[model samples]
Target: MEQLSNNYGEFAHFPEKVIQFGEGNFMRGFVDWQLQQMNKQGLFNGSAVVVQPISQGLGKMLKEQDYLYTVILEGLLDGKTVNTSEIISTVNRVLNPYEEWQEYLALAEDENLEIILSNTTEAGIAYDESDALNDTPPKSFPAKLTALLYKRYQLQKPGFTIIPCELIDRNGEKLLAIIQQYAEHWDLKADFKTWLTKENTFCCSLVDRIVPGYPRDRADELNEKHGYIDNLMVKAEPFMLWVIEGPQKIKEILPLQEAGLNVIVTDDMTPYRERKVHLLNGPHTAMVPLARLAGLETVEEVMLDADFSVFVDDLFARELIPMLDLPEAELAAYAEQIKERFKNPFVRHELSSIALNSVSKFQARLLPILLRFYDTKNSLPLGITAALAALIVSYLQEAGNDDAEVLALFAEAKELPTTEQVAFLLAQTKLWGQDLTEVAPLVDTVNDLVQKIHEVGTRAVIKEIHQQAE
Candidate 1:
């Protein structure tokens, strides 16, 4: 096959209009993909400038490819396998802040740059008092953003509309509040806070898209299949959602609404937020252990398996769905859409990736439902308990897939030797922030399940759970 030009040919020209941070799969596949469509329709003729937030990243390689990459979208689109790829050209350039802080800050002054997008992870929004205003690039993401905003403030009265793509609640507002705290800590002028409150806008946003990214292993085969070579081909599911908590201005900026997508610009993001985390993410956390133990590796596999898929469906529509406050029919429809989304044909939402921050995820997504189930039945959810035990065990040893994200999250899990030890640990109230172990039959059951899982294997333990749940 003939090697194509580095720019991905004529498919690389979306006007340079967006300033982005953290060049990762989620941003490229979701945000840039949306912008790509907008550009094609002449609704948003905007290009993106991605900054490498951390020291090491693909920003250099992204620059090498002339900020042009492929977004291979695959998923169930109205009950059909929709697998397709388009070269995304919105990223006009990428900058490494560690190497070129001045250049990065300079680009922040761009008049055309109306949007600021970031996904530096959940812990990215943090306050570090040690991080000084004069630091080349402040230690925390919020600090770095404060510094950049200050530099921009020197020129104009802060016009850049900020949208933090981080998973934290009201991330944009949280980030803005942190920036203000930094300003006060440094004894910056009051006008800065006033400017933040009035002149600038920071909109809370919920971004949902599973971007598996960089099919390095499948590159050669995919390259041959496409009859073209692309070094930065990003793979992801077709199901995506971007809910921005803002007013009419957002519609004027993001032309996604015009494209007839699930992009919602609203004043209240609670419903959308709950729907995503509870309906979609909640089931994912609940299913991991059962699915993994049932000998299923990927989410799609679990959804496809007769027994396991039924397990997931029942958990979503029957157990978990009733816990949500939305209309029953609407919630059921959302639940179905979520299941189909999980069965993405292009990218696999690996059992491993969903396992990242599992404990935290349970607390946010399923803990409420567990509490509700306990209060109503006076009996605990054995399925949820089994999943929890699996998570705790996954942290204990490097026994599963070679997933780096899971390996990194191992430290965050509860520390215990046996299931009994795990029970004792949960009783502390310091870890889960509640004395869940003290509840009737909960702690002993957790310990017992943990022990059984360790003694046998994931499959045998899960089979028992299925029998008990039946």
Candidate 2:
């Protein structure tokens, strides 16, 4: 029933060493939480100065709460359910550049600033030719950063380790490209560009966590239990991963690994990125339609249903795991964690939500796993083939805009028997991006699964296939 504040005597101020670009739910729940962990352990003796990238943001809210909030971590850790709470106090101050441009520029002059962390959404790392250096904090994320870095260059201060947590692939490189373009367009000195390139280290990082943000439904209950009013309280699952693509120098500068956090500082982030797509996204893509057709609403429901759960788990362990390059134990551990996440009671991940734009999602996530599984063993994976057939059935039942071309191909095969329809769908380059019929027995396998699904329904097909796998 006490108000959350630094005046409560539990929080302390450390030297400002980080400029975080967004005060959104994801950053607060993830990056800021990690920083709080490091500070608590005494491994990283620094605080983040929060920067609101846009004109309208959470600056006032953070300022009111003294940049203090609680992170409620709820999910399964190992095999046990966990619900824990911690007050985060690592954000020293929050500044909105639109309102306080001078203060924002002054941060670049702070010699102690070592890390520039940002998550201004996926569109944040874009190039805008119209953003002038003096246009009241600029328009785009990269432009604002360009102006800040130029100011830092003017002070002749050491460059910061810039790690962007944007969802874009090669985010750091793309950011660097935009900055370089800004320098060229602004006609800045050659030495300044060199300093931008040689002095600063831009790192591409992959951040994985589900921050649902501000548990509004349970706010009053949590407030009464904590005996305090936390307006900015954030909710997240227990799992978190931050993979930074960097060499030894970046590791030494941040040294977050010393805190024993789930931060991977490596030379290549490709494998980790692939592992995420294959193991997490791929399973979701492969299962969403099948689960939906079986009248399953949430992921929790699918996991609780005995027949569906076994099929989903077997799909991950037996089929998908063999396609990934990570160590067997590590992949298995992550797979188990993923299962726990899906079964999280606090999270209600609807199958229909996962089914959005599913054609591209399949192409990006499931298609690669299917192709790789075939290339590795010279045979089609049963689970993958079954899921593909289920998807075709679901789309036929209810089509989407992008599904039009594929639906037309399906219509062309309507006259043919179910057996020939499989081969026809396989050869449609517009659908699979390649003629999947080229792979041995894939057509026949998919054809048989299609007919079986039509005969027995989605749930019955799952039960039958799972029984066969057993």
Candidate 3:
């Protein structure tokens, strides 16, 4: 018998009521997949209409499949390796506003639309001053949303709730405020603001899922067993979290908590938000650069590297762990879980993707550890600092095969006069948001280590950093 693309027949059908702004991996793997569980469990019956937020992307491809795509969830489930794929029929249509602008706006008048979910990346939620109300799609996500909300207000009162899944702090609330900024700038009517205030609700949400999308290389081998060519196959880490800061009414509307899934509906999801960013995401950013330079291709490889292995564990255990407010045991458990996640082996985390704005990433991830180390220990450890130094040198290099993609992505390296003046680049207030250079020993240490990276190869630097940590 011919194998099916995915196990689609097992899941139940639901009313298409959720308007998702992004037709991407995270939204499909995280939000739509979770809804499948809720729909299957008979708690919530809601499907989604995925909109292509950007002008370019998978909208055309998704439309070819009747908006039906396979989600292949891969990871350890209760100590057993479980990899499953099911065609998610929850998406009714994939609409591209750049082409189908009117139909995209028509969703605003959708009376049954209870949720406006989005994951348009970190920079997606911004103000584009020139974005006109009548543009095909506004310059920014918030502007487009503002226009849509205004359309909804004019149609009648509002019934939709917004749950932003963007990887930013207080995503829903931040996006809502940005929309309000658009409203104020454009001088939208008072009734619209009142409708925004009274009729509509923006619930701040924190979502966690490492969705390694479309195992392109492995799809053929994996398909031999399942018996179908599943091109839209998706993969994710075996964990998920959706923490929404909303009232009891939201609980009633979104019954995801009833499914025994990890859905936390609380008055404040701030702690959980901080917990995810500081613990899970922080390590990925901190490790990616140095690990990539050390000849490790994937996160799993980085975790398993004989030299960098202990260095990473020690870095997190000694430097990063103490910065967190959690108990030592709890922090250790989380760190161990992160290490295990890195060892997933299934997902291929490309170093170049994480290397975008890497200086910013280092500031966000490692700078906190550096500062806390000084405040508590009064001296920064050499190994972690050396990793940061290697990262900076990687970013600085103009010619190299490995870091070529990363270097290309950056807006031409214009700052800093010479390689010897690396510390001056680290001192940039625009990058770190504060003067991190003055934070004693860190500046000189990073500068010195960067010089060493310039002299010795990445492998040697990795060995030295590891030895220093030991």
**Top of the candidates by lDDT:** 2
Higher-scoring candidate on TM-score, 1 or 2: 1
What is the per-residue lDDT of model 2 for residues 1-470, given as tens digits with 9 covering 90 to 100?
67788775667679989999999988999998888888887778889998888888987888888889999999876667879989898889998888889998998888999799999865567677889987887888899899999999999999989999976568899999999999999898899999998999999988888676887778999999888899999988888889999877765667678877788989999989877867877788788878888788877898899888898889888888888888999999889878878888986556765675566567667788888887888867788788888887776666643444456776777768755777877788777668888887877777777788778877888777777878
lDDT of 1 by residue, 156-256 (tens): 74478888887767788889999999999877778777777687789999988877777765889888877777787889877788999987788988879
Model 1 residue 260 distance off true place after TM-score fit, in angstroms: 3.1
Q: Give the TM-score of candidate 1.
A: 0.87
Residue range 1-470, candidate 3, lDDT tens digits? 33342243444556778988898888888888887888888888889988888788787777665566778777775678877777777887788888888998898777888788898876566667888887878867888888888998888946578888876777787887888888888888987888897888898888887887877668778777556655566777767888998887877787888887888999988767766776777777767767776667777777777766776777777777777777789878877877777788777766655565565556555666677778888888555577677776676664333223234433244354555355665666655658767876777777677667668766677677666656
Error of 1 at 247 (Å): 0.8
Off by over 4 Å in 2: 281-302, 305-323, 326-333, 346-470
Clashing pairs in 3: none
How do all models score by TM-score?
Answer: 0.87, 0.72, 0.87
Query: What is the clash tally of candidate 3?
Result: 0
After superposing all C-alphas onto the true structure, candidate 1 shows an RMSD in angstroms of: 3.4
* Better structure of 1 and 3 per lDDT: 1
lDDT of 1: 0.76
